[model samples]
Target: MSANIILFHSVLGLREHERHLAGKLGAAGHAVSLPDLYAGVATDDLEQGFAIKARIGWEVICQRARDALASTPGDTVLAGISMGAGVVASVWALRPLTAKVLLLHGLATVPANIRPGLPVQLHVADTDPFFPEPDVRAWQHAAEAAQTDVRIFRYPNSGHYFSDPALPDYNDTAAALLWQRVLAFLD
Candidate 1:
């Protein structure tokens, strides 16, 4: 029951953190593709990451995402990190048969035409400045209302990118727990 997954990187672009995760997923028997939407550009600074994203333009980024997805199966699981979650949202409607969605460090709009019983998991810091509590709640409610099975895991006191060890925001405990849950979700 291994899943075919298309994992989009954050605004910071595809880096070691995402490659490591892809390797982990591959080791776990899942087929994973990590798309480099930012081309070869990458940054450690969040502001610089956003700047790169702005320079790349949203339409181009999304088009890259869509193009990356073209070779995968229709039921491939859609996963993302931070800004990548927005990428997932941008293409979700076009892939109505998506098996599952893994949203890390950010929230994406739940498609109004989502398939019933689709599974979606979200991992984010409880107090992440980028994702306010009210917004997360609203996103969850909307997904649930759309008949999707949604699970939200919030890590208290952890920073937004707690899962990436290379980042200053990394939290070992939270990252371990996140991977544990994510592995189970993929299973």
Candidate 2:
């Protein structure tokens, strides 16, 4: 079946990390659209990228996310990497219930206003410095409490950004498996 997928990138913007994933998903027959949240922000340095992410802020990210959803098919699936995941969750929290959310490397802050039961999948490194097991457990609990069918995958030795080939944290094995799982999720 053909699916419509709305993919968001990490703070690094649209790069190889997700381009390949998008192509794979697209090739698999899913209509994928990746939005550039960092419209005015550009960074050649990793530190600058981090700073830019902090400066761009989540509100802007969420706005771009909403725009992405609006432009995509009505039944588009929300997919994002790291900070992008936060954007997806933000949309989901705001009653964008039509789109299912796929979170790669992070989770959202749950509240009662948002409805539960949205299908959510998370892919994180087991040793991910940013999202440790304890914190991920908390996130899992929140999603579960919301009755969301949350699927979490852990890569044993991969770093926080295991899916990004440009980063030192990249793990080929993890990246490959991640896409395989992601493709299945998209289907």
Candidate 3:
């Protein structure tokens, strides 16, 4: 079940939860790269997180992501959380050889040209302010049009960032189920 994976962190930055996930993946014999899109800066404040993302600039973050992807295998699996999911989506088209995409807390459009059956998984809060139904629908439409093998895992009544234990939004049951599915997907 070994895989070469590139994991992007949320707008809050490369926090411990991202590291913990990387460790879990590594423990399962996967090689993962957890990039810090916000450099070394991190925060819990939503406003500050937005500020950090703006300061770094999305284009710059995308470039860094490209740099990080350059060293990985062509079939590398790309994984991300929240803002990181958006980041991965932005560059997915460029990496035509990407094997799979795993998104947490958000949904992003799969590249239109991706091969049919390219695996794509999204775990999101059903009523998340960050991922309203309309947005999810659009993402679903795009993936469907691309004929991707997509799976959407929804956690009802959960907060936007429910998977991270350090956040108040954390949901133990959902987090456990998420990991269970994620590990099996990677396997």
Candidate 4:
């Protein structure tokens, strides 16, 4: 059940939490590529994180992910957090052979070329300020239209970055549950 996975970091940049998640996945026997889309800068401040994210942009992040995927196996599962989820949604169309997609804290539009029954798992807060209802619905509709086997888990009353321990928004219960379900998905 081992897999080759490329996990993209969130706008906060690549930090210990991401590496912790990668360790969890690796412990489960999956080979992981935890890429730092921000190169090396990571912050705990929300405003600074946003500024950094805007500077790096999604296109640049997608290119970095694409370059990482180019060297991995064809069926490498693509996983990401927040902004990273958007990266998966952006490039998955170019990787039709991807084994699956795992998203955290955000949702992305299903590309036109995605095949039916492609497995996708998403974990997010019930109502994330960063992820609006309209966008979530749109992404859901697109996934359904494409017939992707999509599973969405919503953490009730949780904060946007509920899974990050370093963030004030962290919820222990939500984070544990997320990992439980994510591990199941990985299996």
Candidate 5:
């Protein structure tokens, strides 16, 4: 069951990491779309990334995300990295038939209207500053309450964006495991 997937980039913008990931998914026989919400601007520093996001404005960013999904199927899988997870949440309710959600390095709200049994996979570092332990627990509980099938993978001692080799936070082992699980989930 190959899925049509729209993978959103992190606050750092649509860089090599996302393109590489999309290629990997494509190789696995899945249709992948990589959207550049930042309009070609990218930054490695978190603060600068947030500034870029702020300068573009949240509404515009989300509108771009929605626009990107316009060409895909309703059941297209929505995947995002870090701040991209929030982007997924923003547009989740609008796409009730989304096949599945893959949240990497962040957490997203489970919409009340989500289809029961819809699978959501979250991968984050245990001590990730962006996703504190308490918040992850709360998000999981909320998803469970919504009757959605949820799987949370916590990489102990890894960095927030541990899967991106371009960043200092990258963890080879954790990133490998994350991709393995993600591919299996898609299957």
Candidate 6:
């Protein structure tokens, strides 16, 4: 199957959240790949989750992304949530892969070295403890400065990682709306 869109998951790896998204994108006619970054090591506890991800090593995580990219066919649209988003951003920086970006649950600081006029979308929780409003606004300015078409949607009063229904942080309404925007952006 030919895929034009691929989404990598957070350090949590290929869970329902990522799989569900892949199904939606596949239904939208984009071959989507949700690679397993964690490689079977996962946790429900937030601190443990962070620790497991850290243990995996950034370079390994990055190379896993590379492997996923190499496996996917056609011109691809890169998308990810949380740490996955960070991975894509890292890849975009080092390799400059030519694809639109759809970032969910996190924002990657667009380096001063990178300029953007291309399409980019970000879906975030308005009250995300990890990414405060001030930080997101600053990111927006930087993205805009690079000419990136940055569209950031905020889920007010929602917890971080709102898209993952299995997580306590999930918000149904916010997740649904985020899906709608993601569909439109990928289209």
Clashing pairs in 3: none
The Cα RMSD in angstroms, rounded to one decimal, for candidate 1 relative to the true structure is: 0.6
Give the Cα lDDT of each candidate. Answer: 0.95, 0.77, 0.89, 0.88, 0.94, 0.79
Model 2 worst lDDT window (10 residues) = 92-101
What's the lDDT for residue 7 in model 5?
Answer: 94
- Please give the distance, in angstroms, between residue 47's alpha carbon in candidate 4 and its true position after superposition: 1.4
Kindly report which residue stretches of model 1 are placed more than 4 angstroms away from their true locations once superposed.
none
Q: Which is superior by lDDT, 2 or 5? A: 5
Q: Kindly list the per-residue Cα lDDT of model 2 for residues 26-100, writing each as its tens digit.
A: 799988897888885554356777788788787877887787677666667877788777777687655545446
Model 6 lDDT per residue over 1-187, tens place: 4347767777676677677778878888877777888886765567877788788888898888888788665357778788878987776765355467888888876755554566889999999998899999998888999888889899987998888888999899999899888887777
Winning candidate number (lDDT) = 1
On TM-score, who's better, 1 or 3?
1
Model 2 has a clash total of 0
Better of 1 and 3 by lDDT: 1
Return the TM-score for candidate 1, rounded to 2 decimals. Answer: 0.99
Q: How should the candidates be ordered by TM-score, best one leading?
A: 1, 5, 3, 4, 6, 2
Model 3 Cα shift for residue 113 (angstroms):
1.5
Q: Candidate 5 lDDT, tens digit per residue, 1-187? A: 8999999999999998899999999999999999899999998888899999989999999999999999999999999999999999999999999999999999888888999999999999999998999999999999999988999999997999999998999999999999999999999
lDDT of 5 at 134: 96
lDDT of 6: 0.79
Give one digit per residue, the lDDT tens place, for model 4 in 1-187. Answer: 8888999888788999999999999999999998878889999887898899889876887888888778888888989898888888778888889899999997767888987898899898987998877777778888888999999888987999999989989999999999999988888
Model 4 poorest ten-residue lDDT run? 130-139
